[model samples]
Target: MTLELIDIAVQDSQSHPRLAGRVTGHVRAVLSEMLDGREQTHELSIPVWADIADGTSQSDIDLALMLKAAKIVARLKLSLQSPP
Candidate 1:
């Protein structure tokens, strides 16, 4: 899907802002060890719409949705680090 669509999905989560907080928390937890000392940067790319063809399975569709949500959360975190 296009970045605009992904952005829209992220915006939708604003209605439940706590979801963003939870996602950020989980991310921090996962990286806590690596973040303990010194500063580091990492790059990630999540394909929200991959292997989605005419007859994609329901499970695959669900996974794509989850990936899209993850992408949204990552975007939210990055935005937080930006200069305001």
Candidate 2:
């Protein structure tokens, strides 16, 4: 399976560029791991937006993004099995 990440946009009030980069990195890793070895022939474009509030911990952000990535992968798998 081929996976391409077009873009990741993060919005926060604190304007933490470093934190945003970390979040996107974590997200990309999670998505890559989840989509690895999948039998996806066509392209699937999934746009995910995450909002990080002030005072949120890094672990919490990572967990939430991982869950979101899992959900996206699960939904895609289901859709691929359905008839057109």
Q: Give all candidates' CA lDDT scores.
A: 0.37, 0.48
Q: Any runs in candidate 2 off by more than 4 Å, and if so which?
A: 1-48, 82-84
lDDT of 2 by residue, 19-71 (tens): 55333433342233224566433333334445677677866675566566657
lDDT of 1 by residue, 1-84 (tens): 111222222111111243321221111111111334554444333333333455655555555555665666557566655375
TM-score, one value per model: 0.36, 0.43
Tally clashing residue pairs in candidate 2.
0
Q: Give candidate 1 misplaced runs (Cα > 4 Å).
A: 1-51, 82-84
Q: Whose lDDT is greatest here?
A: 2
Number of the top TM-score candidate: 2
What does candidate 1 score on TM?
0.36
